[model samples]
Target: MTGSGTPPTTIPGSDARSNGLPEAAPNPGQRVLVAGGGGYIGCILTRCLLDRGYRVRVLDRLYWGEEVLGHVIDEIELVQADVRDFPGSALEDVDAVINLSGLSNDPTAEYSPEANWQMNAVATENMADACVARGIDRFVFASSCSLYDGLPAGMHDEPPQSSRAAPTPPPSTTASSTCSRWRAIPSARCRCATAPCTAGRRACATTSW
Candidate 1:
């Protein structure tokens, strides 16, 4: 085992007495933090994650509802907190973050687009940044299709030549531009899934979840 020649061999599944391949240990919580866990979707998500053996934490303003989470209060970590003031320390060991706190496409954005932008767009962008900075790469954003203002002008049934509007792959960068670049955190594994409609989750729960 000379340094210049080859490193010492490591036995599979052995301790220091032989070679230091570690013994199997239970998963390290595989922690997940749901940003709005008191809401309808958040509560259900927490339970679903918990049932799958992932450790879960709930950080919510709880302005809408908390009763949905009452039964599982004992099994989870609850923080009545806002995304703007998310405590960075708690995220240190977390594996993923699913942010659901935002003003849904409600009429209130008209009163103050500034506030809405701050919470919905800016805060979410910053949340991604924070997660990357802290090595939590997996981030799932609860955004809406409302942002997709433009679509392919031609229906799928129509031939390409019949299309009135030109389509050129839409710049080949929508997802990366909006989300994937932030997943570069080397230590943190990442995924950004736009949660489907509320019904999607419910349906998943019925069959696969």
Candidate 2:
């Protein structure tokens, strides 16, 4: 991972000023807590935030390795821990949280569906509750387009009408349900990025709920 001193124009779908939060003004002084910031996508995102002048703290299990963030290791605060049992102190000074802390693909989920459900669904709800209790309003969840897997071809672009209509795999479905349930929290500004990412191309649809 590489670190830069420039900040990005904005965080996707965040409106810090709207909910009585601090004015972003490009967020130079804001600190973002990125859960799972050592993974493939998370590493890239962590570097981007650092580039944009935001202070970043990464909470990750680092099940793979930390070499992915070697280049910028000195620039971030790294916490080696699982999200499921993360301490409340992780949210203490955090202004916003971007959760990318679950199993990334089908094979991993299939290997242990129990683990998948706990990480993708239950852990997410627990974190969101913690954020709310701490008065942290901004939460960005990295969801998957796989939630639309069983939809008819024509309906792929549309949000699933109901859980029954989607019939996605257990992991993806439960993750999606977690996103929906948190959308109703008045103080939480929940944004879901449904990504259909590939080695050659990455496409994401960001929706605020």
Candidate 3:
């Protein structure tokens, strides 16, 4: 308390600063977290980020061949941790996050539905919450399109994108579609690169979700 009766505060660096919450902005160049940086597309993204001079930190279980990023190992920081158990410290001082971890697709998913849900669905939701708590900026996500399953026999194939050439949903039955059809492959892994919550950090996503 102040001598007169008011609470007292001081500067941070120069002998006295208020709690020091905003003394200066953080330097953003240090590092970025690529959650699934070892996956197919993630490998490319990791290289691109490294080429630009940002410190790259890759968090992956190496579910696939680790060689995917062999060419650039020296230039990146690798973390072998599953997103489901992602350490809170992993989000610290991170400029961005590109989430590419998840159960891949149908065949693999059927192998173990419980595992898929635990690794893909649950982990993603938690990661979103963690990022919010951290102050990290930006996320690029890649999600599977399986969630859009239509009623049994109630839905038809989506129309092509090239034919429409406009912002309109294709008619219920367009013979051919400009848009490419998505297929579920055997691999079952989380591909949610960037989720909606990341957008608050001006995140960029590559997934369909």
Best by TM-score: 2
How do all the candidates rank in terms of TM-score, highest first?
Answer: 2, 1, 3
Q: How far in Å is the alpha carbon of 143 misplaced in model 3?
A: 0.5
User: Over 4 Å off in model 3, which ranges?
Assistant: 1-30, 145-209
- Winner by lDDT: 2
lDDT of 1 at 106: 38
User: For candidate 2, lDDT tens digit of each residue in 1-209?
Assistant: 23497666664335633433343335676888999899878898888778767899999999989898897799999999998787788887988888888887766776987887788777878887787777776777666444544445452333453334323455555665676676776656654444433210122323111
lDDT of 2: 0.69
Count residue pairs with overlapping backbones in model 2: 3
Q: Candidate 3: worst 10 consecutive residues by lDDT?
A: 174-183
Instruction: Please report, in order, the local distance difference test score of every candidate based on alpha carbons.
Output: 0.60, 0.69, 0.54
For model 1, which pairs clash? Answer: none
- Cα deviation at 61, candidate 2, in Å, is 0.8
TM-score of each: 0.62, 0.71, 0.56
Alpha carbon lDDT at 5, candidate 1:
72
